[model samples]
Target chain A: MDQTSSSFVGFAGLASKNKEATKMKAKRRKKISGADLAFRICNGIFMVLFVIITLYPVLNTLAVSLNDGTDALRGGIYLFPRVFTWKNYETVLSKDNLITGAFITVARTVIGTLLALVMNAILAFIVSRKNFIFAKPVSLFWVITMYVNGGLIPTFLLFKSLGLTNSFAVYVIPGMVSAFNMLVIRTYMRGIPDSLEESAQLDGAGYTTIFLKIISPLCKPVYATVALFVAVGQWNSWFDAMLYNRMASQYTTLQYELMKLLSSVSNQSSSAEAMKNAGEGSVTPTSVRAAATIITMLPIICIYPFLQRYFVTGLTLGGVKE
Target chain B: MKTKAINMVDLKRQKVLIFWAAAITIYGIIFNYLPLAGWLMAFQNYKPVTGLLHSQFVGLAKFKLLFSDVSFLRVIRNTLAMGVINLAVTFFMAILFAILLNEMASKGGKKVVQTISYLPHFLSWIIVTGILHDALSGTGIINTLLLHFGAVTQPINFFAHEKYFWPIVAFANVWKETGWNAIIYLAAITSIDPSLYEAAAIDGAGRWAKIKHVTLPGIKPTIMILLLMNVGNVLNAGFEIQYLLGNGLVQNVSQTIDIYVLKWGISQGDYSIGTAAGIFKSVVAIVLIVICNHLAKKHGEERLF
Candidate 1:
């Protein structure tokens, strides 16, 4: 990525050959010399300050999630753990904290992302084909969707009609194809130079073979981009879980499980009725929510940077065809 | 080739398209477009059992209620306020991070920062809020830090404070997406021709000037396109973050239209009003997109259409 090595390469390149020319300019720069120095110093300070202010709360939260709840409440922890104990984690990991709920979350995320990719891939490829007569209408359909959506109640009722109101499919099926992902993909596939298909045809390859062996492999950036979106969408999603999963025993994703736990904790400190229900069987509201959220975030966070590299290419030069 | 061309792709052989399109359109029809019928409920005194047509039409009564209601007014204000803050913070932080990463000069450093920053984007709001809850609680890490630094005598109870709520929301947004958002800018930066930088440097232009002129102008189209596209999402200030981070203490400031629809429409079973709110959001989104597109066209920027 540093095409010819370190910053030193660029810096030295900027310095020596251009020294006298830089010095002549430096005299002019020296006119506001102190001010320029002040400006640069200010820019440096502000940048660091911004990063800290932006990152501190999140880091603090991470520290809290790792801290003992009782000690965390007592204000004993700051910057680092005062009482470094895995008790909160142990409390969370125990099945008493609704381990089945965690399983349901993992299942939903895996199943939902996979289904979304499959649905989007199939449609995108079809839409990508040059002579596909229905492509215009299909693409228009996706475009209009980006602007307007029917509200939640109708969507809920729509899911209910399909008997998805309480089931895991409610979360997975309705959201299978995002318009953004579809369009980006269609834009990408359109780039495959129709001659590739012609050449494939000359070699006697069928459309299916062309798509599988050629198009899919060629569109790696879009594939990675779409996969990341689906994964993130499924991972961070608990609202649907809350909306559909009205029962405590129902399959709750990690997000919903954490929500159920946190809300219960707040409800406990806030309401006696809620407190009575707190830390009860199949739900250790306090520690489990923390654990579930951390656990659910693990895969996405882990995969993010690698995916981000491809994501950059996907956004930048990736859409050259469309 | 002649034999295959003569045989052609008959409908029978087009089973792949048929099966796949059928599978997805079945999804689209049921989940996406079919919900349009629910908009009719906004005009009806809707009952689930009686269904759409049979439900008595109540005209613009719900919309009237929405206009006159103080809560509705508050909802709009809250939505706009948070939405603007979220947009500004996310936009700037993303650009800022992209600039910083550009300066880092080491691939490993860029990769590490990119990884740390993007991790949050994947976590559930449930997890993020949980983390914030413990961090910002009365006796939490934030208070402890401030107390240690003597910034204040005690923890400010961040989640409950109305003033802190929006800032927290904005910061949370920046945390989750600033890096992810920067990827677009970084991409745009990479597209900036190296020759332009060389020319600028030949004239002895410093790093800052090069960025202001060369890099910034180069990315202006990308920025403008993204801005127009994002105009449609202004009303979508996000639901999960505000819902989870905000409590009664900050409810006035935190309750956006989406949450209002959730409370009055869904939670309480008022489908008509919920649909009305939904219709309101859809209308605003459409209007924003149209206006932004029109404005982009007028300015001769790349039009989304």
Candidate 2:
């Protein structure tokens, strides 16, 4: 008798669920309010405008980069190349400083991201250990670094004193550990179950062994996120090169080379000289700057879509604790 | 004796952890904490030749000079104006874009729009500024449109003018950040309970009414927390864009606190004055953050700390 009565209730629940689903379907079909319709139309139009506005500048830059240098100076190019030429790119890619800069930028990005990830992850792992005695103090020690800093001059002075100036190590060493990234990694590590470590320890695995063989492997997503952040930062950073490595042409990064080009173009007088020197008159400063801009951003654009999924998750994970 | 034995065992167990911690701690001391000693330069008439040790102490004279300087005052004004404008414009646009995106019916289309929107955030400032320069050039699309529409007989040199600097900076910020900032709000919106929306629908509330009552309140905490965090960073109006886009024509308007520091501290080799300006900026930041966090706690909102 109990079973029969439960079955009857379950049937009633299912019927109500079906009724609700149908109601939702009907509601979705019956959207006829003029105000609502107007909002939808307006919203649609706004989204299209937003997309165009966001894209048009980049697209226009690409167009300028592809167009004939002299023709582009007349400045009617908008979306597509009016007079197509590869000379701009050929000119930009052929420059000695730019080539050196690209090599340095790529090397720094790769090396910096790897080193930073490992250091931050290890620090995070140590703090995240539930039984670690100095966890709270160590965490606080790093977190304080986020708020207070030595400021620009002192940092510069310190680097200069340390002989980090005019060296490749200047880029990789000073930024090896970010407090924010460490915290994000710590937050992720904490969510990991302690049982995994406990079980590993029971099998006579040491802390280092557990960290390497167990914890780090499980942290692929957050690592991807942090790596992307660091790589992008390393790639985009030019101020350090401008500041510390200004005299070290060998250590110059791509962004700095682009910056030099951009300033020259903006200055107008030097731009005419720059144009004439570039590609023997086929590449104007405008075209060359656009091409350089495109080249500098191309790697980021190519990798962005692929890494988009990781960043969204990473951001949310970091956001949760912070 | 028993307690000592237990302590030994605990220490033995923690030996590896302590080793790693000590390594990182040393690094932190050198890279992070050691920089604080440089703050003393603010109190000195520092010269690189004499160094920090032998530099003569000047007891707030540099701060006094900073406060009294006309250019410094102008720099402060520019910083505050640009900071406030950027904060308000970017904050509003992000929220508005998020809400509109949330209201869209087609999930696939929304995703595509969002993907496109975030394309600019990945591009470096060098690239963004380059694009801005081209678009704002006299012969660029903006002037071309303006001239074609008979808005002006002559092309307006956007970068040459002082009046357009702040708006252009703010617009550049909005263009670069709006889509990226919207991600957090969009997350907050998605996490809102669907039952609440259903209940509103059942109560015969229209779309706008449902959004007003349900969606806005749901994301209020996120909005407040982010706002507080941003307010603390008010002084960092951005050095790169201003420094990049700025020229001799708009130096008075374009110069910010960071640029002022760079000029006095780095360029002019007045390390003391630069450090003083840096300290001022840092102090304001800390104070603002503390106040905002306190306010958030008092108002029963999420506190960053």
Candidate whose DockQ is highest: 2
Separate DockQ for every predicted complex: 0.41, 0.50
Candidate 1 DockQ, CA atoms: 0.41
lDDT of 2 by residue, A116-189 (tens): 99999999999998777898899989888888888888899999999999999999998898888998888888
- Model 2 docking grade: medium
In candidate 2, stretches whose alpha carbon ends up further than 4 angstroms from where it belongs are: A1-28, A269-279, B1-6
Give each candidate's fraction of reference contacts reproduced.
Answer: 0.53, 0.66
Q: Model 2, residue A189: what's the lDDT?
A: 88
Clashes of each: 0, 0
